[model samples]
Target: MYRCDCKSNVLSVLLYVSECWKFTANIEKRLEVFQTKCLRRIMRIFWPNMISNEELRRRAGVSTISEIIATRRWQWLGHVCRMPIDSIPRVALRWTPQGKRNRGRPKETWRRTVDRDLKTRGLTLQTAPTIAADRAKWRSLAVASSTRRRRED
Candidate 1:
């Protein structure tokens, strides 16, 4: 009961519009910490009685926040991929800048993250739209991706 409410209400609000978020390591860490804290509180597990995050999540029947975020991102990507070429989001997704950036490591972007996810599934940005055009295939991929545990780097 409590778990369902926390997931449906709190998690939904917490992740609202997250499909467009540029997920960096720091952001991922913060979200994971916040979710762990919330889950611990809801489960009434206080200090001195420690539990591994994996164990806690297993008990709570929840996927990691990263998994949830990744699932949402891919789902959104599929939608964007299926959009008409003239649509703003579709155009934006395929847009490339004409200028060079300041000299350092390139910043991680939402598009880059999506590309990475696609690569993990042996797909590329070029191929993704083709696959996403088929709703059944994209839906299966989305479900499969969500069920697979994320590996920590």
Candidate 2:
């Protein structure tokens, strides 16, 4: 596990988004040929033998950058869950600054993402904090949600 920095949460999310964009920039779409080539190139950096992308993915248990980011977010969420309600991390999670709405489509918030994740696991925002307090259960929920999403892809 890693320490969570509440102040750096937004920055960390941005960095994750940028890294994911960089990873997929070469591919126009997630076509199999492109995905295969990309995976092969990545694998070759660590192995010399020519191997089929399928074999490489199987051996490595392929996971997308988004999946990794989601895992990190969930871990941080668990940490926040364990904090006192008045603590900085927990306060940040619950805080809603009063501001006028922008004139265009609204920017996504971390709360929205958390809500979506919880919804996927048949959980509600009201119940999530309690569930997240149990490290093992929370970790399993995160993994199960990610695995379900992967299967849908």
Best by lDDT: 1
Candidate 1 lDDT tens digits, 1-153:
667967997799999999899898899999999999999899899989989998888888888888888889988999999999899999999888888877895689888888888987889989999999998999888777666655432
In model 2, what are the clashing residue pairs, if there are any? Answer: none
TM-scores for the candidates: 0.90, 0.63
lDDT of each: 0.87, 0.62
Name the regions of candidate 2 deviating beyond 4 angstroms.
1-38, 44-56
Worst 10 residues of 2 by lDDT: 1-10
Model 1 RMSD vs true structure: 2.1
Q: What 10-residue stretch in candidate 1 is worst by lDDT? A: 144-153
TM-score of 2: 0.63
- lDDT string, candidate 2, 19-90, tens digits: 212223233234344444545554453456767654665654554546665777778778777888889878
Cα RMSDs of all predictions?
Answer: 2.1, 8.4
Candidate 1's C-alpha runs over 4 A off are 103-106, 150-153
